[model samples]
Target: MFGTKVIETFKEEHTGDVLDMMRDFEVKKRAISEEKEGNIVLRIPAAFAETYKSLNSNPISKHIFKGRFTETTKLKRDKLNINVGVSKQFIARSVSNNIEHAKRILAENECSNISTILLVGGFAESEIVQERIREAFPNKRVIIPSESGCPQRSSSSWS
Candidate 1:
């Protein structure tokens, strides 16, 4: 009753796509790398099954906006993910901004001469971020552990 069409019609029209996209992101994100520029993605949230309009209303949880999503990842039993195609330049700029901010903080703390940078957040697991750090700080050593920062958290990725 809440949907514009009948329930069977909605499932017939949307479920295949909804599920396929979820499957794609779950498989693809693990293999993201510097050599391969993959689409950025967020999972199709669980609420998606409840209503198509739910994403438009939710901000913190919803990832899709303005026709930008490509795939989905429901790899976890209770999580949702969507594939995104973010611009490479955008990733570079974002990494640059974060680096600049960190440097500013270091300088303020009188550590301007620091030589090594360790990326430790969940974002640190990203190949794109790792690549950018290497490129941006060619003169400095960058250290990143192999494990994800918050392995148990559900949904979302930095795009």
Candidate 2:
């Protein structure tokens, strides 16, 4: 079928790309930063920002469009040069402070006998953050949940 050929052609054209087309910068930033494999490069288009302002502010469309912009427009890929950088320095200070705060919490009288450290949330998902926590509390048992983003229910809650 001609439609099948068109779909195949589209898929072939976008085989190695992170997405079929450019999304908003926030989406691109997340995709680039969270990539664990680390070798793939995405060339952000020059017109990437233009898409953000493309929708005109018509009074008729304003009411319906107020909070409904999904930023899902599909645009043609460009060969424009783009650079993205993620720095460990950005998070280093915050992690260090967190480690220090954790130490202070452990120093409290009630927590003196605590031997287990449970790390949760998005920050705990980072290997570097986990390693830092393990290094900070070598004698204590450190636990990182597989689903750090989800809230865990205590055993007492089941009853």
Global lDDT of each candidate: 0.57, 0.52
**What TM-scores do the predictions have?**
0.49, 0.46
Residues 102-142, candidate 2: write the lDDT tens digits.
99999999999999998986667666677788899999999
Candidate 2 yields a Cα-based lDDT of 0.52
Candidate 1 regions exceeding 4 Å error are: 1-31, 37-43, 54-84, 87-90, 148-159
lDDT (C-alpha) at residue 133 in model 2: 86
Residue 66, candidate 2: Cα error in Å is: 34
Candidate 1 structure, TM-score to reference: 0.49
The TM-score obtained by model 2 is 0.46
User: What is the lDDT for 121 in model 2?
Assistant: 69
